[model samples]
Target chain A: MKTLADLKKIREKAQEEMKLRGGNVRIKIVVGMGTSGIAMGAREVMKTFLEEISNRNLTDVLVTQTGEKGLSSMEPVVDLIEDGKPKVTYGNMTSDKVKKVVVEHIVNGRVVSDYVVATGN
Target chain B: MSLKRIDLLICCGSGCVSSGALKIKERFHEVLQEKGLVNEINIIETGCMGPCDYGPVMVIYPEGIFYKKVTPEDVEEIVSDHFIKGRPVARLMLQDEEEKTFSTQKEVPFYQKQVKVALANCGYIDPESIDEYIATGGYEALGTVLTTMSPQDAIEVIKKSGLRGRGGGGFPTYLKWQMVHDNQAEEKYIICNGDEGDPGAFMDRSLLEGDPHRILEGMMISAFAMGATSGFFYIRAEYPLAIKRIKHAIAQAKELGLMGRSIFGSKFSFDAEVRTGAGAFVCGEETALINSIEGQRGNPTPKPPYPAVQGLWGKPTVVNNVETYGNIPTIFLKGADWFASMGTETSKGTKVFALTGDIRNTGLVEVPMGITLREMIFDVGGGMSGGHKFKAVQLGGPSGGCLTTQHLDVPVDYESLKERGAMMGSGGVIVMNDEKCMVNVAKFFMDFCVDESCGKCSPCRIGLKQMLDILTRIDSGYGKEGDIEELQRLGEAISKLSLCGLGQSAPNPVLSTIRFFREEYESHIRDKSCATKVCLDLMHFHIDKNRCIGCSLCAKKCPVSCISGSRDEKYTINQLPCVKCGNCMDVCPVKAVTKVPGMHPEVAAKRLAETKLSHNYDE
Candidate 1:
């Protein structure tokens, strides 16, 4: 941080971290925690994701929280982002459904199309 | 990893947050994880997107689908239909006034009409995270200036952009920078005028809170260009959020080596600090702000040595407004010509207005400079609220004048507004309706001026009080015949003899209202009545005999029992005993109760005709 070179080095490190965390990353799970979403069982859904990610020793998977997705009534909405691909959204999720998703989608790389709310690229 | 197929930008501005935007983000995470669709789509929380009334707003990028008023129930439909099915939910998309759905933010009338140079990254990037800012090419402007551009070259670019001070006075920013640069003082200073004291104006506060790094970069450029060793952000204590965000941005920039010693490896070094004002409106004036920063009384010194000549402990300094500084990073990123190309020939670049009051869309709007007030009210603001007619739009915050419907078509540039007795001071455009009394509006501003008056000069100090007394007397139905003439006289004197901008522009609201809505003042004076039926003293409550149902409810409900009649007979309000409290009007089932001015049909007819005339002008 003393000189321009130090800033450049930090920037490189930041870019590396972004590369590890961005679209090219293995998997990203974002849960909507808007006020209404949280009121409608979204917090439990988020907890299930944390439990599933760690319990299965799943690596290359990032779990994050976002503000309202502007679709509040469908609270407890989750967006699954595969590496360098489109996002798959699932709504009205439960802990059992989440465990099945971890086994079928995250591990088996199978698209659970029936439970999906939408697909976005 | 730097590239995401889909980027969902959620507006986390104060307005959206109040309407539950935060919970929506958390829901997205929970649902996405359970579905095993994580990390592919990036959800970035951004600042204000201007459409505040339509809160909990979001714009999904790449496709840029905008959604509004989202609730937990609709999240599933949006997730299934738009995300998994690869189809955007039509019902969730933002609907314009015409009921036509807008897929992207650019398609919305409020945003499409605007050319956002200053607010380019606002509501698009995370304000707290410097990496987000850098990803959007933020500090690259500073690096460009420090690495290659000279102080002279940078100043020339700003001068060429035709960017004036956005605070109040439309003074050229580069000229001020040049003045401080030309000075031979060993140390010069750059003071950012963030003490936005204008009532009903929060554009500066929003920008500071939304994109603090932009202002920092702008300040850093000014410091480098002016050869200043130190800089200060003279933000007011009223803006606690803005202060916190800016403080964080400064710390982040300093840590990343974009601020402090040898910025971008150049030999030049400039460091900035925050100085909070005690929330005095007049302290927004440059010299007063400088005095406050120097730990002295925030009284403005006269303009022989202007702040550019001698400022901040008696050194050469350049003072620029927060919005003015917000433009610098963009001017460098996109050349001066690019900046100059958007606005009018004279007033280049975009202007951010905190559009509030009776306007339907009350939020921050940054339109190109030459856009007419008509477009701002109708196209962007979605017209007047509650079906009320547009009467006058008060611009320039407390220091500005009220522009009537006749002036709506005028191009909103510095010269046009000044010519109409309104100066484009700070960007607080309050769209008033027919319900608002002009004289009362003038009084409100004059009262503000009186309270904020530093009492330095006789014209601004004593003269404003005399004018306020006249306005009060006029508004209360005790006005004399020559009261209007006396107010005009005092207004001119104050403008001529006042020491600072506060004194000089103190008479603006009064003078402008008098000029545009003269009939309101005349009715108040000649008829001892308010044209808009606002003043209580001039009203006479009467029940229309034709429409009366003879319920006698008004009589029973009257606090004073002023109305008298049998249940079957048409009720009449006894004018002598009537308190004019408007209870009878409120209680009347058949809408029989009406208030006429001065109990005369002819006067009422005349006022009705005047109202009709103004309504015609509004359309």
Candidate 2:
């Protein structure tokens, strides 16, 4: 019951995702999924980012997970790696903030300085 | 001219995965694609990178930039700046004790002192992935044994490793293997004792859950050495996660032609199965464990024709605890001398202990044999919680003894611990602070043993109950001068006559406490005083008028309403009405409620001082 076009579409999508790796306007988002981070709601925060990116059709942003290395007092951590700027790590993020990050930071090319862990200050 | 690719390593250890590491991985992919950087970044999930204190952590390679406390919101900036511009995030980096910035994880003090051997693959490899484990040189020893070395050769390698059982008995592992090997039985069995019943212990659970394949590999190697055709993992039903992971690992290994038959096309064929325990504490004993596997009551049986001689279904069997089995593949992989050279001469290799109680870092620790108690408590355990004064440390769970500050210098090995009136009982080290009452602690352990006794032996069943009653009476200010002597006599009798290890070691806590802190017992008996103010009946709560604010908080909160007086004035506790519940003491905002000996403080103090001074003379 399946068509070759569907298979071709799947292959094309995979190829497209593979091809977007080296774009200049790319955005990288890293979420902390360590035990403490997950206990503090990192799962919801991560799902929100994926939903927002897909809904907004933003293809320039990449998301990933990282391990815990101490600082257990604060978890559900997020690190933003923007082009042409210093990386910033944030903590205690929520779903709404993930939306703002996708729209304002990824699409508009502006670092939401308030939520940034390090503004290089 | 060049294409850029960033590798994001995520921790998927239980501690991290439960914190949402998997979702974080998904979010990373979504955000990367949305920002058009999906192709440039490769997200990989790794394992536990110790320093569990700052867990849910990830480190960026190439630059070796370390980040802490990262959330979803911060992910965007990390992507925008670091991966895009290559400028490291300074604020996200870890800070030292002096608040100095540390960019790399190697600079962290918590990691610098640690020498990891048992936990080598804990955080670095994907535990669930077989390829990662194989890439990291897993199962090479099993391959070597099946392909090159004979079963006898494998046994010799184990003997040469000087690997004693890590299950606290200090029994040489290879000897046990050889005993089972020499036994003439057609259906010999090997069992991994995963029923870790010691309180505050999770070393077994973590190893089984984190790296099931390693344990499986070890079991396979052990089976080969002992000529065991089949093995059973006797894990307590309490560890659902460990059971699930191990079952999965076994199934996968079977599918890969490694477990069922003719592994790697060798003449030998072996398989494994899991048997769930009903969570009986006594099942940790080999005899009790074997009995439980037979679908019978888990009661300890007399030894001599031990499990190695006649075991499950009347066949020769070899049994090793979780930590002992975990050390097996490593011994075979690294060779004998490498494993032998790490610890003391008598007890070689590391021992994983669950450091709990008053320690600041309440978690699992694997330290080499012969490490002093002082070093374990201070350097590794991060000292007492809340910086309280260190008083004593109880080793080996209920069957173990408590060591005071005087014994801090004693090296922790099987022989040393036993010589100090304590056995290395499943490696549970519970640190106690100055606030603890040694006598009360002994009573607590005695109570636990009394409840857990299988009642098969009359001496243990009756003697422990009698000792508990005496301890309870002494702690309640009703003990006479002869009670201590009676308890000691009964403890000795029970210890000498008990049938199995469980019954034999039931009185260890009481005996050890009496040997070390006899004055504490004497105070309760001779002076009718609880020095630590733990026994409610032996303490009298009085309000110091100077410190009392007369807020009426104590009077209002008292269940018996024993506290009487006006709010404008000071409060007085009616002695007759006071139930000694300590509710007034807890509710007092100021340090007004003072606990003094019910008899007399000066008399109690004098008696305590006399007893302390005469202790050495008496001994």
Candidate 3:
């Protein structure tokens, strides 16, 4: 990936992998690490995302961390950014729920609406 | 990992998150796991999918089944009925008046009507991964240009595309690039302006947060076109997410060898850095943005050299807006003719608008330039929320204009909008319902402008203050007859005599509202009231004797003890003690409370016709 051609080659390989994974299934999991987020068990939720992405061998999934988004009500939250335009924020994410999220959300692409703290842009 | 056949994409836009999308997601997990359908279905969470009002929205793959407003209680029903029985819960889908559901995503009127260009990859790509962006054919245009087209030829392609700045005022993209390119200097710089500062606008933030690679690619293309050594992405500090995404994107681009020295092994070598804004709305303006980027106070200098000749520490710099830069690669990838084909004669390509405020389908919508405001509201926005009649659409934030019902059918091109006293500054169309008072809306924007004013010039500083005072008086029912004329006179002076774009366009909201809804202002001045009942000082709560049951409910709940008379007698409102907070209205179980506004009789009639009053005596 040190050259332009390498960049193109990898992109082509990624496209092939995308086809293997059904072409349109790139997902991002964000764990809130803000003051309220950490106080309300956000660190465990963060660990869950990293563990699950690796365990599942999901090539397209990305796990990131963030601080308090000022919305204190939905603490210990995780935002699932898939496809982009719409971001779904799930609140009070326990370690127990992470497995189910991995199976249904990451694998199945089913939205866990009960925990949806934030919905649109 | 092996993939599942079914995918459930949930909308996680701001509207949906606030609407409890997280709870809905958790409910889906519980139901799916319990039903033993967890392995069979895959759930993916995405960003705002246009119809934010209907969030937490989700679409099931294979069938493209659309669901909206999915509560935790309803998730069980959806999983059972839709996943197990292969029958979608018809109630969850967006339905017409006939109770028929629009099951498919395309069938939903909101998604079908939009033309996604700058947003072509947004809401449909993984923003963090450069691979996903590349797989979607992202950076191919940059690659192709670096290997094939000359810098001069690249500029020519952009010029031919007829692309204009989407930040507002609709400046030509190619001309800016050309100016920087033609300017002889030891060094030149190119930039992506991501400082989105409009009140109700989130288009730029959405673009940056959703698809950062697109913006980076756009900047890279500009760097190649203008022969610049470096570029910067000036994102607002308030948008931490956007800033992070851009930072990630630049790193990824560099790692992939798409950025840094001798890109693609060509002589054209360019790089970019991320510089965050310090929460100033005026930084959206090019000159002010540059100042902010250089660690100076964000202030706009007069533009004669125009940054193209001398900018960014005395170098020719081309600062294309975030949305404007997003269009650069699209024009190069698709032919200029193709990019030019979608929009009107002057305004080419699609424009992304943060469609929100009192509108049903409140989200980011990308539409061709010539689309009508009527279609934006009825078709794209899914009509006004809460059964409120459409009053006006505030375009281009405070610096823009308020377009009324009369301008509904008019094409939303840059020139067309400018002709009607509105400039297509940043495309942020905030829908106003019948309940929204026009004078108050103008005053709100005026207040925003006055607070944000740099105070470098007396015209904007002193002039805007005078206007705000006048509007405040009128709204509070203390307006004199000559206030309207005074506002118009002062508003004109501010627009004319102010320095920079901020001051020059400071009175646009007031000026445009006065132009379209002059009668609303007239009613506020001549009658000493607001017809919309929004101005608290201009209205009084009255006990409707016909509806009052003498339950003493109104008297019991009056925090100010404004109500008089016994339980068996007609309760009268004492004007002296009344704070007008309407606590009596909240506690009255028999529906006795009502309002009497101060406005013209005819204007009151018109307002009543538009507002379907329904008071739920529940706090």
Candidate 4:
């Protein structure tokens, strides 16, 4: 707080805390939290995504939950959204699959077609 | 978990707080706790989010969904469906004038047209939290000024920014800073004028309450540039919340070493304290404000030594309005050209207006300079409310003039407004509809001036009272020929000869109405009628035979029992006995009773005959 560097440090730290409020983000990870999705372990998948994103210090990435993306058969579904690109829906998501999705689709920009249930603009 | 999955930004600004926003917040907390989602969800109380007409407003982050008029009862549904179930509540979203729904705060038409410069951190951050202000790039301006720029260089940057005083006068800000900087008084001071007493204006109050830290930073920057060692915030006592928040902000800033000696390890140091005024309208004038702060009666002194030359116990000082200081940090943070790029030729950057009256979206708006009144009223303000048509707009409070429909297209800048007979006083824009009587409007502002006049100079004390007398008789149906002319003469004399700003501009409301709405005055004087029926003395209530449908409701409701007729025939009001209280007009179920301007036909005829007989006798 005494010097210029201290302010910059606090700003950087606070900006991370304030990131979710921002409209513009590099990536958004949406997990379906409908009753069916939660019954099928969507909560575990969502937590795993948050853990991975936070562990890697992904400041520009956000993890949010939405109700009923409607494909109950693909319960525990997750959607990877990036600006100017089609939203990629990963079906039958699990704690095991969240890591691969974060690494391939999020960190490396390689869509995992094996788990892809849908691609929408 | 550094970040909550959902953030509920509930507006706790004074406007929203009065509408039960705090209760809504408590209900949300209780519901969230019951639902076991308290940790994942965050509820933060922020400042004014504009659109105060539809408060208490809440904005949910991540999705940026905006909910208006939220009640405590609605909290359970919002927490369960929106928070836990992740589905936004659709019914509570904002609807624009066109009946189009808008969910996100950014997409709302009221917000889209606004450019928040002075209000950058107002609704967005928590005012109590200095870290939130810093997170939004707050005191970095002070840091930069203290570390990199010399005092002269800092003043030059402000001069280049083209930020004129937002307080009303449109005086170039850097000139004041330079004058204070040049004066080598060891105990020079800076004062933030928060004594905003304009009717229908809360722009300064909102800034002080919403972003106290920003104003503090602005004061610090001004102090640094002007070489002032200490400062004072002269806020009116009426704005208790604003005063409390500002005092709290000063304490926090002092705790952080942003205030007091040797700030930021630099040689430059600045500090400030809060002083509350007794809510006198004239104390907003700089000299009067200084006197009030000096514990004297708030009467303005004549200018030879302006506040910049000698102020605050005869030391060189700078007094800037709260909103004027609100713009300073941004000018330093963003370069001068960046600040200058937004506004008109003479007036630069944006203006924060407390838009009120008949406007649909009544709240605080900070729009770029040169935006037309049409855009401000229709686009940003969401047009007129209650199915009323636009009549005229009162700008700059009692000190400012009214602009009519024809002037709607005029660009709203300092020079343009002044050219059209209105000064851009402290930005209080009161929009009037056709239902408003122009003469009455002028009288209302004049009455305010009469009450608030410090009674220092004869022109203000005696002259303004004379003008108000003319206006009073004109509205009271006792007007005569040449009354309008007499008002004009007195108004001109007062504007020219009054001692302080309060007296000099007190005649503006009357003068401007005379300039733009002269016909309303002529009608009031010659016809003894108010077109809007606002002056009850000048209007008569009568039941229309065509629309009455033999309704006896008017008869029952008339306190004077002047209405006669039954359901078999159309109801008629006995005009002679009617007190013109318009009770019959209010109770008419079939659109029967109407207030017609001037006396009743029978009454007029009787008066005419009596006058003619009197004239014959004189002959």
Q: Across all candidates, what is each one's fraction of true contacts kept? A: 0.07, 0.00, 0.25, 0.51
Model 3 over residues B332-394: C-alpha lDDT tens digits? 878999998988988888889888889777888888889998988888888888888988889
What's candidate 4's DockQ score?
A: 0.52
Give the C-alpha interface root-mean-square deviation per candidate. Answer: 9.1, 15.0, 12.5, 1.8
For each candidate, give its TM-score against the true structure: 0.80, 0.76, 0.81, 0.94
Candidate 2: fraction of native contacts reproduced: 0.00
Candidate 1 Cα deviation (angstroms), residue B289: 1.1
Between candidates 2 and 3, which one is better according to lDDT?
3
Ranking of predictions according to TM-score: 4, 3, 1, 2
TM-score of chain B of 1: 0.90
DockQ-derived CAPRI band for the predicted complex in model 4: medium
Q: After superposition, how far is residue B487 of candidate 3 from its true place, in Å?
A: 1.0
Best by DockQ: 4
Residue B492 CA error for candidate 4 (Å)? 0.9
Higher-TM-score candidate of 3 and 4: 4
For all candidates, the clash counts are: 68, 67, 58, 0
Instruction: Return the lDDT, model 4, position B509.
Output: 88
- Worst-scoring 10-residue span by lDDT in model 4 chain B: B599-608
Q: Give stretches of model 4 more than 4 Å off.
A: A23-26, A41-58, A82-88, A94-121, B1-3, B97-99, B546-551, B567-570, B601-619
